[model samples]
Target: MSGENGNEEESRGLKSLRQLIRILSVKSGIDEAMADDLFDFLLTVDPEKGISDEEVEQIKGYKQADVRKVFRIFYDLRIASYRRGKHPDTGATRYYWYLDSRDADLALLRRKLQVLEKLKMRLKYEKENEFYVCPKDGARYTFDYAYEYQFTCPKCGTMLVPDDNSKYVKVLEDRISRLEEEIKKDERRVFGR
Candidate 1:
């Protein structure tokens, strides 16, 4: 029963995908076949938008890693925002990409919004977080009460200096701005507003 339901959902998703392809073809004045290619391209670029790597590879007549390589190529060309992250448990890096094309534009927006929220959380953590360092030796401290004593280091007592450069804050802010610009571009392309 569950398998049947899953198949039903998959069929519905494919139907909607075809409808989207037709609409995009009408909007962009492209042929149905070309629009279908574009739609499939978007799905392959961003699997989380209801496409899987295996499915994309099947459609493209390539291996899954080959699809990932294509995604990397597009990323290097600045065509899409490809994300690569390492799994903490397995230490294997996986890549996910986004194409701001019509079929999956909302996925890009949602990803940008998620990044913004994460940046906000990181900024809060950075603002509230404190760091301590030993003056004699350049030992670093990253917990509360790291330098509770005055002008002293736990390892080598000389004179402690607060290492609160907080350079990461600037980096995060820059990333947020870049994502915002990308989201704006996608919005403009989709809505022309």
Candidate 2:
């Protein structure tokens, strides 16, 4: 039973890692296919040594430039690392890349904090602001902006109506609560706090 619980925790950690990678990759606007490729490659390799340029080039049908671009996307996310070294056989210069797991945990922690702060600010705004929505286009605007448009939709000329965003407030509140809990747990694990 204890071993099974350990496995479950390990699985949860892995799922969180994958989720973090997916979020970071999508937020970077990297193509989903290319991001999957990079993730798969890293999963198959020993992270300490990473994979060489030649190995990365083995990704079928991808242009060298495209592969490099994928690498750059990973590098930009800070979850991946790039380094150069001498080939043991040929003594030629070679480049390698790999996932930075420890750094990734820290980055995810920072992202959770940023998201928590942003959500709190947005929730406050949602609570404080009077919102108007265009009946035709579903476009939303603040009270001041809507009043400037004379309570009319500029795009479609439909009347702007008061929108009750109570559901959105609930959603934001729930998200904020869940994220705060997750961050607290992750902090305890990652920072030993």
Candidate 3:
């Protein structure tokens, strides 16, 4: 039924949002549990009347400082926004936070682009460089560095051998290809292009 389809779509959106929050948490060095809690709370907020961080702390039982930290990360990632307002009871300034769906999509796209660029750079380096590894210590070095050191392991005094990086190169290429396909699909979905 149409209702089932609607529910499916809603769940998919939530799943994507959760994944984005997890990524942001790792990148910002925040606790994933706290970020998930904050994200779930934000989902219940009315966009027109956003909820303040203090309210979130009171309702969610999270430390005010921790809530603020997560909110700051969300803001920095462009997944959330806040508006300044005065508390109705205290007549003091407060910030009410809410998620902007469009901004979240844009942020996701930007992140994907960044990852794609980094992967491409890594693939290029892997393809261009010849690597050497110490047979005993398992330490890896570039061809130039190994040659400079007389193709020996400094720590163990073991002769260095050529490292076969074809597998690694193939893995990078596959990842880059998959990520490129995903980005193209996301662009079509988000931008209708």
Candidate 4:
């Protein structure tokens, strides 16, 4: 029974890690396959240790430039940290990467907040912009742009009318609210305060 419980807990942890990698992949704008490869590579290192860029390139079969791209993505998202090291004999520099799971969790929280901030900006734009729609074709246009056409549908030649975007604004507001709540929860979980 104890063995079964241990296995179950390990499986859950593994699943959660996979999910987090996927989220990190999306937020960092890196391909999921690349993220998975990086995650696997990171898994081979002990949490107390860091891996060199050359070692990672060899293990992942990626060239130095490709490895740099991956490293930048991880670094930008704060999923990993690196420090420069020098070869004693050759005087060459190398980057050592460290991916602590705790850091990854905090980075994910920050990424979510950034995404939510962009969404909020878009929502604000929607709330501020005036929209006009052609009743015949249901085509929409911005206020000044529509005036150039004399407020008529370009496709159907119908006069355009003011579009009531209250529902759209409300929907955006609701989405922003939900994201803010999720961010709060994520912050609480990651920060534990």
Q: For residue 43, what is the lDDT in candidate 4?
A: 49
Residue-level lDDT tens digits of model 1 in 57-132 = 6676656764554444434434445456554567776544566344355544544555566676777777777767
Better of 3 and 4 by lDDT: 3
Candidate models: Cα lDDT each: 0.59, 0.74, 0.80, 0.71
The C-alpha TM-scores of every prediction are 0.41, 0.52, 0.54, 0.48
Give the Å shift of residue 157 in candidate 1.
Answer: 11
List ranges where model 2 is wrong by over 4 Å: 1-101
What does candidate 3's lDDT look like per residue over 1-193, in tens digits? 1234444544565577678888888887889988987876775576679988889988998888889989887787677899999999999999999876675555455656666777777888889999999988899999999999999987788999999999999999999999999889878867888
lDDT of 1: 0.59
Estimate the lDDT of model 2: 0.74
lDDT for residue 95 in candidate 3, whole number 0-100: 95
How much is the lDDT of residue 78 in candidate 1? Answer: 46
lDDT of 2 at 83: 80
Among these predictions, the greatest lDDT belongs to 3
User: So what's the TM-score on candidate 4?
Assistant: 0.48
Candidate 4, residues 1-193: lDDT per residue as tens digits? 1234444443564556567767766776667787777766764464455777777777777676656666676676566777778755778987677765566655455545555666777777778799999988789998987999999888888999999999988988888899889878867877786
What are the runs in model 3 whose C-alpha is more than 4 Å off?
1-100
* Distance from true location, Cα of 32 in model 2, Å: 17
Clashing residue pairs in all predictions, respectively, total: 0, 0, 0, 0
lDDT of 2 by residue, 36-100 (tens): 76665665555568777666777555666656776776676576786888888999988788777
Where is model 2 poorest over a 10-residue stretch in terms of lDDT?
1-10
Q: List the residue pairs that clash in candidate 1.
A: none
